[model samples]
Target: MGAPSTELQELIELLNSENPRIIQPACEYFSGLSGTVDGLNFIIAQEDIFKQLMKFCSFENSDIALLALKTITNCAQNENGTYFYMACDKQHFCTKSLFKSFENGDERIIKSSILLIENITRIEAGARHVHAFIEDSKLLESLLKIFVSNKPQYQDLSLIFGNICQVPGVRKLFLKNEGEIFNKMLPFLSHQNASCRLGAANCVKNCCFETDYHQWMLKDDSILAAILLPLAGAEELTDEENDSLPIDVQYLPSDKERESVSDIIVALVQALHKLCSTQMGRDALRKYNVYVILRELDKATIERDGNENMTFEIHNVIQILIGDDAAECDDLNKLEVPPEIEKKLTEMENA
Candidate 1:
């Protein structure tokens, strides 16, 4: 693309002006220009403009920092702009600054940074670049610290970490920290915030995709109970049990929030289904009495059946958990030798 206009150049200069009054409007104007990919690409072509954004990303003024982040978030939304940002990010300076914002910037900056990182991770090249920076900076551990503190942004961090785990090598690293990650996430399984609970469930589902995690999960009854609690709804958690719950259980939903409530239920069930593959996992399901919860939920759905596929998935998981024939889960039993090869005639019978 051709050069950015003189007006764009003036606006870029104003972002660096001493006055926050000038910087805020300038950042807003740039963010507006970034509404379309072609507009963002044209702006990205202006290397000075891109570098200025990286500077303002760490502005002492919170409003400037947030606005700059918004502009970057808009740019990060386009794949071409994402590639350009990662490509032009020399010595990993921009990545480091962004993580710094996550660490110290106010709520707006933290949330915007999470969105920017999420947008970047959606592109494979961008994800790999982020993985490399995080590996060098020990950023995962830093995020884990923030998570342990239970900041409100922990919900965003959980979702961001879940997205990062989609990268293969990064997933392996997360698997190493599985215990700590699970310890933090499990409580959120019962969190009052619907988004927090949903993010936790999604992270649990992705982490459990590994065989090693499945083995660990099967052995942890506490986790098994925690995973089933949301799907089982209020009935599984008594008033006495709710009083001592790890987090305050959300009060039953009103009419307006019913859809959000349903979405969280689906997420929890999906996470449970990820656990039903192995015999050990199935045993754990029964040990935790997951079948009872799922059966009740399935029956309720059947009586009021609106969503067919979700009901089918929940039903399927219950069957696998309760099925008598091990062959029903043959896919999970594949490590063993085939029956014909393992079978041998007794010598006495042969005689």
Candidate 2:
């Protein structure tokens, strides 16, 4: 009825890293065969498959075996009269085996363990199940310790933190005290490594999901302002007439350095116009000369043929705060545009 149990026995033989290339091919070939009871039974029956898989887990070589394990667990972890992962009601074999792996395993097992537990927890048949054997308080404490630990830098930490960020409940567990984990992660926002900053941003993004983080990012003129400071030295080094100097030779600091801190200023204003559109956002935006910025940005989003999507959202914010445009200037494009304030004047024309 099935491709003789030899295929299953062969896959189990391929589970160890000593076998090397066999693991992935074994997974691919066995993936199609996992649902068969004869195959799964043979896989579990094979000598040393479980122990080698558990040991190989920490090595990058273990990813395929872990995936295969997760796949087999999912196929076997059903409910309903159907012969699937439903072993929960009929028996606890499938879910219990997964929890045992999580209980008596290293971090290599966490990847599949967390996934299998979440799947079991969310199962229609296992609705009443207490799937997460690791308590939130303990897990958050453990994860935070890793964030500040002096241990080796493993990419696995990034993947784990990234995964935690997606689950709302897990995130609350990580950030419940506000000052607890946040103070630790704050410095990494500008760490020398780009991945650390990106990971920190991702963590911030998750934490500030319900709050207005962009507002917070802009609250201190320092953050965005910082990006422009270096860009100034960039302009002088540009070779217009000749290859005058390297891009931004570090000249002695001067009063002109202040001007260097400045940009078209219109560039960021333009980005913000596309961003802040609601009443609260507009009010928070008004903290800076946000209206003038939006006016400048609206001028920029315009096309050769006409204006862009900003007319509606930008104008909506303008209308809510300042009232309708005066009867004479309601439709802005009709106004004569001056070349000097050509961009600013287009605001009226585009409106």
Model 2 local distance difference test score? 0.43
Clashing pairs in 1: none
CA RMSD for every model?
Answer: 9.8, 13.8
Residue-pair clashes per candidate, as listed?
0, 8
Model 1's C-alpha root-mean-square deviation from the true structure amounts to: 9.8
> What does the lDDT read for residue 329 in candidate 2?
42
lDDT of 2 at 84: 35
TM-scores for every candidate against the unseen true structure: 0.71, 0.40
Clashing residue pairs found in predicted model 2: 76-85, 77-85, 78-85, 78-86, 79-86, 332-348, 332-349, 333-349
